[model samples]
Target: MRAVLQRVSEASVTINGKLHSEIQDGLLVLLGITHNDTDEDIEYLVGKITNMRIFSDEAGLMNKSVADVQGSILVVSQFTLHAATKKGNRPSFIAAARPDQAIPLYEKFLFRLESTGTVAVKAGVFGADMKVRLLNDGPVTIVLDSKDKF
Candidate 1:
């Protein structure tokens, strides 16, 4: 599993011109899943994201976690995050998990995130054509991969 977490002042997801979900003052997470990903990956990321000290404190230092600021989170499925572009201009999606294997993991990840109860959790429909919009707070973005954990 991999995730691109962007700190955002506000974010929303639209599908076919209809609003799906939205969040304010939180993280907009673009999540990708591979065939090998499991609950462990979800656990690792949930802990990291909720506790990540990217938000600023009153002293103007980046010392507060999203939980500390009572933020929200909007997670979207983005299989393209795993695109392999080494060989050609046409990227390969062999690393992305097929829907049959991915949907369950995606649901489980969302469930776990919500279970944390530290922040409001919202999500985009899996496998839907979603248009996401956000006001990136601090323009802060972080990429995390379970396979690369050291």
Candidate 2:
């Protein structure tokens, strides 16, 4: 599993000109699931995301976690995170989990995240063609890959 976490002042997702979900003063998380991802991966990432100290404190230092600030999350599934481009000009998605295997895990991840009562979570339609818009806060973005935690 991989996630690109962008702290945003506001964020929304639209599908077919209809707004699906939106949030304010939160994080926009672009999540990717690979074939080998498991429940442990979900546990690790969700825990990290909720507790990540990206938000700022009153002293102007980045010391507050999402949990601390009572922020929201706009989670979106992005299978392209695992794209492989080693051999050719075109990127290959062979490392990404197929929809059959990925959807269940993705849903489980959302459920797990919602269990953390500190956040107000919103999500984009899985596997849909989504248009996401956001005003990035602090221009702060972080990339996390479960496979690279060592």
- Residue pairs in candidate 2 whose N, alpha carbon or C atoms collide under 3 angstroms: none
Q: Candidate 1: list runs displaced more than 4 Å.
A: none
- Clashing residue pairs in candidate 1 are none
Query: Per-residue error at 98 for model 2, in Å?
Result: 0.4
C-alpha lDDT values of all predictions: 0.96, 0.95
Q: Kindly list the per-residue Cα lDDT of model 1 for residues 69-117, writing each as its tens digit.
A: 9999999999999999999799999999999999999999999999998
Best by TM-score: 1
Query: Could you tell me which 10 consecutive residues in candidate 1 have the lowest summed lDDT?
Result: 58-67
